[model samples]
Target: MTRREAGLTLVLMDRLRTQRLPRLQAMHARVTAGDCLDAHDLRYLCVSLEETQRMKSPSIDTREAIRAVLARLYHEITTQALSNEQARFRHAAH
Candidate 1:
């Protein structure tokens, strides 16, 4: 890769570590704690996923690692959301 491309890759990786990863981790923790994600939180996740698709890092390992983390996050978020929906349904049926 060219020097400029390498520089961009470094910037993307740094942003992932310093900015995106922390936010994602926090969301994962919140969902794991049984808190239903709000619409804004869901929207952010969608946008983040879309942005991740657009990212072009030269490191296959880094991309795979990010994808794995995202998959886990998606799972937890959906699981919590499902639990919340079930609780609401039960509440309404009573």
Candidate 2:
């Protein structure tokens, strides 16, 4: 990646960490706590994850590592949401 690309990626990563990640974490917590997540929340998480995954760093290894961490967090949020939904369904059935 060029210097400009690396700078842009750094800015994007900072924004993700400072702004998007907090909101995503909050929503994940709510979902795990049995609060319903609307379409907007899901869309935001998906888009943010996609954008993070696409970011390019000056170093290939650094970029891959950063993407891996972000992707893992996104995956955890998804898994928690799915587990919550299943639990809710089971409760309803019971």
Candidate that would win on TM-score:
2
Write one digit per residue (lDDT tens) for candidate 2, span 42-68.
899878977887788777898788787
TM-score, per-candidate, Cα-based: 0.75, 0.79
Query: Tens digits of per-residue lDDT for model 1 on 17-84?
Result: 79877898888787767667788988988887776775666778877887888778777777887797
Clash pairs (backbone) in predicted model 2: none
What are the Cα lDDT values of the candidates?
Answer: 0.77, 0.81
Error of 2 at 83 (Å): 1.2
Q: Which candidate's lDDT is highest?
A: 2
